[model samples]
Target: MADLAKEAASLHKAASGLRTVRQHTAKPLQEFESASHDLSALGALGSLLGAKGDIEEGMTTLVKLAKQLDEEWETEAKFMGDVSDAFDLLEVLLTAAARAEKG
Candidate 1:
């Protein structure tokens, strides 16, 4: 029982750290999405203007890849945050149950 409480406390601490990571990463993810949007918009404008040179084509590819990367990053961050939340809940429930059992 003591060991269980200790493990729960450790997991709670890790969840807190995970929440911090989520908060810190969110701002950078937003910036990355903004940059990706700008690049994609520019690519569309260049295409409309018949700017089909090698550099422009390369940029178009880069924009596609950037958008994909942005999406993946967003998904990953959201999952991380969700996992943190679940861990937090579990820690709370386990701690409460342990206390009740002791009483």
Candidate 2:
């Protein structure tokens, strides 16, 4: 029971850390989109090579990927929190059941 408690504590800590990460991720992803805007200048060079369409297409793909990553990370953080809460509830129920059995 002691070891189990320790592990549960560790998991809760990790979940908290993930929630923090989820909060911080937006700024970096926004910066990434800002940087991608600078890359649009490459379109001029691509035009000379007749690859402007390809460059624009690639840029669109990159933006979509960044958005996807942001959404997925948000989802994962939510899942971690939900799982942590479930464990806490399970622990409470188990303790109650154990005490009832002893009585």
Candidate 3:
């Protein structure tokens, strides 16, 4: 019974830590997504304006930057998903522990 309690406590703590990580990462992820959208719009605008030479090069750089941001966002999203999964698994473990203790 005591062992089950300890395990449940540990699982709960792990879930809480993962939630904190998710919270901290959420804002930066949102900001990256917003910036990527803005960059794409700027690139389209440059094309519509008939950019040439240096202007075209700048636009290209912007596109690259946007792509990089998108890639980073994807990586972060995957990390968040993994963290969420871990939290879910911990929750399940805690639930199981509780049931075991009760039974």
lDDT of 2 by residue, 3-50 (tens): 546656777777677657646766876777666556566666756886
lDDT of 3: 0.60
Structure candidate 1, residue pairs in collision: none
TM agreement with the true structure for every prediction: 0.50, 0.67, 0.49
Off-target runs (Cα >4 Å) in candidate 1 are: 1-52
State the C-alpha lDDT per candidate: 0.60, 0.69, 0.60
Candidate 3 residue spans exceeding 4 A from truth = 1-51
TM-score-best of 1 and 2:
2
lDDT of 3 by residue, 1-103 (tens): 4454565556555545544664566576567645544444456665677643455466557666755765665566556566656666676788889899999
Query: What is the model-wide C-alpha lDDT for candidate 2?
Result: 0.69
Give the deviation of candidate 3 from the true structure as CA RMSD.
9.4
lDDT of 1 at 27: 72
The numbered model that scores best in lDDT is: 2
Span of 10 residues, lowest total lDDT, candidate 2: 1-10
**Arrange candidates by TM-score, highest first: which order?**
2, 1, 3
Once superposed on the true structure, which residue ranges of model 2 sit more than 4 Å away at CA?
A: 1-7, 22-24, 40-44
